[model samples]
Target: MSIRHGLLALLDQGPHYGYQLRTEFEERTGATWPLNVGQVYTTLGRLERDGLVAPAGEDGEGHVFYAITDAGRAELRDWFGTPVRRDSPPRDELAIKLAMAVTVPGVDVREVVQAQRRHSMRALQDYTRLKARALAADLSAAGPDPDGPDPDGPDRDLAWLLVLDQLIFQTEAEVRWLDHCETRLARHRPAPAAPQAPATAPQASAPAAPQAPARRRGSGSARR
Candidate 1:
């Protein structure tokens, strides 16, 4: 999602001010990633600097309008013509957590995994509920016969539903992975060992009784 390319594509459609571009971009993207006015201006500035776009004129409110140039059109065409690679960098948070968990001692990894499973399940439930509600509302507003087609229907709703479906699938997959993690952790945990008592040293054998004291003591007592 290059901001420069996106702004150029919008400008290619027609000349527009920064604010107008921002509004249109959000609308077209279903407001999934809200664009700031500053970002729009920044992207426009870059596009102007690159000679992909140029200032058209000022509007009634003194906002400068920008129009795509010949070079911009060529760039847009190249962008559209190019195929995006499906091999994107992976961002697996659970993998990182599991890697670190094994390194930490006394970390009760099972508990950590179970907690994540609970959280993921809750998220899946919430997303499912939201999707159901959205679909119901879309049907209700669809008019008389539920199956009747909408003559003036907008495809934006369908696009939103598709996005929601993707999110739901991702969340469900995460929940299933969490369950597997918990099961594996429980299955692999080692059982606790029983404690042992300390060993006592054997008592030394008693030495032979000392010989009786010499009779000299008795003789000295008699002389005294």
Candidate 2:
């Protein structure tokens, strides 16, 4: 996600201070990607430098407020008009790891892959549990009452349901991918071999000719 674009979109609504922009951005995006105060300021600075945004005025506290310029509005409109290419590129770390796994040593690669899978699985489990809880709460809140219906009730909050759906879908996909990775790693690992004993030096054979040599030496001595 482009922070610059996101901030520009937010500024298109109206002029806002840096802190307000940061807060509103988080709220609109369901706080998915956290925004640092510094990042917001930095993006604002870039937008101002590029003539996409300008300082509108100051608030009571003298903090500079920013408004999207005509150029920024055009940019935002252009962004919205353009279709995002879902197939633009793959930025998945797991995919990168698997691609390079062949070049890495067996144990080292297996360890890294397995570690990633384990972490992914754990994250999936946590997300699943959280989704379940959210669903239960949503259901309870949306449950039909025997006596009366809420005119301004939980049924109105379909926004959270949509967010939950996206979260659950992503988590389930991650879990499936992790499982596939684990299976592939297991298949690629070589089977263990039986251990062998250490090799020893060969023993020398007895000297059959030693007896003849000794006898010749003794005869020679006696003769002398």
Candidate 3:
């Protein structure tokens, strides 16, 4: 999600206006992470300030264009060469929600898990459908033997498919995680009370012994 690097990479291709870069970025990424015009301009301004990009003159219609500097190209190259590090994972809202649900009093964790599972499942289905359509479109555009090793050239279709596949896989993993949560919650769930027997005769020999309270599970002990 480094918009800076993304804009730099796009500028490496050639000179482009803010709007043009935004359009191409969305097209290549299948609009998975949409960018607003203001965001694009803000990133561009930062790039210009950092000497990563320079003004490439305006078009006939008075649109300011930008071109990547040599430094920007170097940065883009490094970005492409390096693997994305996950040592510090980003905060996920769903994970936080689930954790809070389990800890908060009077909250049904199972219901929260089920709701998330439903949403994730729906998203997975949608991504699957998009992948199917993308494959069909690629095949139709590639003519016969689309899987051949010989790539024609830079293929934006392939770029979009790769991103779409990543999204689908991520959604599938989320659904599986939600299922695991549901199972774990069920295992920890409190047992139901047993039915009482009919009333007996009043004359009891000795007083019944006092029973101890059941130990409640602590919120701190609930992992995820």
Report, for all candidates in order, the number of backbone clashes: 0, 0, 0
Q: Where does candidate 1 have its weakest 10-residue lDDT segment?
A: 151-160
lDDT of 3: 0.87
Model 3 lDDT tens row, 90-120: 8999999988888899997887888888888
Q: Model 1, which residues run further than 4 Å from truth?
A: 28-30, 70-83, 86-90, 140-153, 187-224
Model 2 C-alpha lDDT per residue in residues 1-224, reported as the tens digit of each score: 88999899889878999999888777655576789899999999999999999999897899899999999999999998998788877497767877787676654665666687678677767767766776786688777789787663453334445665777687678767767766876687664577888898798987876443334445556543
What TM-score do all the candidates reach, one by one? 0.62, 0.65, 0.80
lDDT of 3 at 200: 85
Q: Weakest 10 consecutive residues, lDDT, candidate 2?
A: 152-161
Q: Higher-lDDT candidate among 1 and 3? A: 3
lDDT of 1 by residue, 105-186 (tens): 9887877777887887887787788678868868876768667776534454676677678778988888788788777766
Which one wins by lDDT: 2 or 3? 3
After superposition on all C-alphas, the RMSD of every candidate to the true structure, in Å, is 9.6, 8.9, 19.8
lDDT (Cα atoms) of all candidates against the true structure: 0.81, 0.77, 0.87
